[model samples]
Target: MATDKHCKNELAAPSADQCMDHYGCIYENNHLITLMVDPADGSIVDANRAACSFYGYRLREFRKLLITDLNGGQEDDTGSFLDRALPGGKYRGNQVFHEHHRLASGQHIDVEIHTGAMRILGRDCVYTVIHDISERMRSEKRLRESEERYRDLVELCPEAILVYSGGTILFANQRTEKLFGIVKEELLGRSIDDFFIEKPLSSSEYNKLKAMSGIKDSFRIEQRFIRRHDRRVFDLDISGVPITYNETATLQLVCRDITQKKKETERAVRLQEQRHAVGFPLEDKAVLDKLYIPANTLSGDFFIFHRISDYEVLGIIGDVAGKGISAALSISALRVMFMDSLHSGLAPVEILQDLNRRAIEHMGEDYIAGCCFHFDFNRGMMKAAAAGINEFMYKPGGGEGMRITVKGTPLGMFAGSTFEQTAIPFQAGDRFCFYSDGMELLFSSDELCREYEYLQGKIAGSVLQDDCTWLSLLIT
Candidate 1:
């Protein structure tokens, strides 16, 4: 027979009476609140020292209360717990549940109950070890809230961001669904390469040693992708950022769509090549060496020299108001109109008026700054006029250069616009030049003086210089 004295030596086939000494030792010394309750009525039969103190009750007082009473009228929940915990009054299994327990002082505390079936005096009893888990539960809830906030922030990001390790995707933001056309669940755990039409780095180019040294630059590639839902092809500019996520080294891929922009860039290059073919090549005259370096694909400035009679040549220089395709197209239309007027041998003033009217008719409302000069070699006379362009410089053989005035309102503003011509008697060595207003902006003060000196040298013999210094908003 088992005795309390024998328990001090060794636990016999355990029963409440015989194992009381061993059980009492554990009950007295254990940190957890413990109790023995009759499985039949959920009533407490025994209370450990910790349980008595934890509930603000003495041992005898704690024993009279039902376990369900401590759990705040949770008889049904307690019954369900017992069904799983003891299971037929014969099981030695344990079960755990979170429940609120009331203390003798009327304070409520959340506890984690770990219960097991025990035989005490040949009857079924429930042995429970309860841990106060209030703080731990609160901490877990806070962690969940923090993670939810982070997810909300990332979901609103415009760029598709993804984290992957070992070639498999671990996380993706909300934009991944729109950008890649795959739901977040479907994207997760899939091979990272599955979405991209373009593969990642070449095997030889991937250097583990450099990556470990933190010297690895993030790799970027413009690649095509197959959208998962629509299966449509799209372009993406992807950057592979090496990072540590969740304490593990991984690659975060950030992608942007550039399919439309990519095609526009390609088309612009082709148009730029064709744009260079517009201007004419002059027969090399000792006085002029021409070079046009456009700031972009097209130039807003253009010039032409057309021979009218054996001894007369019409020199034209013009600038459209702005640059690019719109300005280039306007210049083209104006060029055709001006040439026709010049061929008809219209006076410089009449040529300006005719071209202005034709330009407004064909090109709609537009701004043009232009100068046309008719130089007669045999007659030794020159006639020049402009619309928007006001004056130009002239120098004669053995004479100082000075500005010659010929003014008109810019074309296309109104039908009543008028033009005036400036005529001069020419000598064999008299010269003039026509240029765009942007010419001055391209040069600094010292550069301008230096370039003017160079131009003076080129025109020393039969000189003609155009001093068109119409500075507006003054290029500083």
Candidate 2:
């Protein structure tokens, strides 16, 4: 057995003779990739079994090559690494060098080498322990790319976003600067109390905010924000959501300016209330009951009834295909067209054709789903024509109720599209229900009161996703 001083330091045996045999056994059978190189000439002095398996080189072949041969001849070769690893021939604790090494197959891998100065049989040498770090490097690269993409999205967002902790602003997006009328450098480190008129957040309130995990769990409120430069107060809808920023729990505030929206909403409410106050033209004839629920302040669904004669009435119900103020304006135009058609004494089919033409010319790209019907009390007949508003529930006097569906293209869809008309006979005590597409009903009962209660319960239990309107008529 060969005597090596490195073993005496590592095994801590009582004497050099006792550690000689154990050192050789441990070095030859160790799992870690190990190598011993002559520091003076950079020649490979010895290699363990693990190093031979990792580099695909026999011990004899490893001994013939220099350390730089396996290191791909990088500038930080054996001599420079040894200088950094063991300055002044003394081993610096935990000195590591990150480098690339080439295998026997010419493949290269990222590695971190732990090097130390050692003496084997009175000769100076450098012992290196190598570890593969390719996977960790790839993971770090992916994390960097993901963070860059997230930063881009936050900068380009339209709404103002700010990250804060304990009422102190930590981060703010570009929109935040524009909304607050302050530069980003000035906005950061400012207190939330400076901008908002709301009460300062208590310690408990902040803890509650930090406990939130998702958008649904967040807190939202409408408040007033004062601009830092002009001190002008504006309405804002804000949401506070919990997030992790730089390994710290923080609250992110998303603020939306709603000053203009509030003004528009007030005007729309006044108009809708005035429209509702107007009397229905066919009120004296047979408007038994009605319901109108708009999803927004302005409604897209509308109904109008005009009595043509003492024994006859004309009624039309429709839904516009858009939302907001634009859809409300379309309903206004449609109401005027319906009144004009009825005054001219046009039939149901002719009235629909005329409305379709007017919709294409005046409504631009907006379309409408409408149904018009004529009731003749003396003739005991009802005639209905539809475009897009196709299905209706009809219950004859002393008969079961059935759905009446007519096939027709929506108004303003095409210039030459045709419509179909349906006619059914009815005596006294017959019931009719006309509705827009937003109303979803099972029609389980023929009575109008039961159906209306079902609809009311449905609306009460769930959030409204669209506008709904229904009209019930009874023959007397």
lDDT, residue 281, candidate 2: 58
lDDT of each: 0.66, 0.77
Tens digit of per-residue lDDT, candidate 1, span 342-456: 7555578888888777767876666778887776666667788888767666656666656676878777766778888988876655556455665544433323223345634
**lDDT string, candidate 2, 83-112, tens digits:** 656777676665787877899999888888
| Candidate 1: segments with Cα more than 4 A from true spot | 1-19, 75-81, 105-107, 120-124, 163-165, 170-174, 182-188, 199-253, 260-476
State, as a TM-score between 0 and 1, how close model 2 is to the true structure: 0.68
Per-prediction TM-score to the true structure, in the order listed: 0.46, 0.68
Which candidate number maximizes lDDT?
A: 2
What TM-score does structure 1 among the candidates reach? 0.46
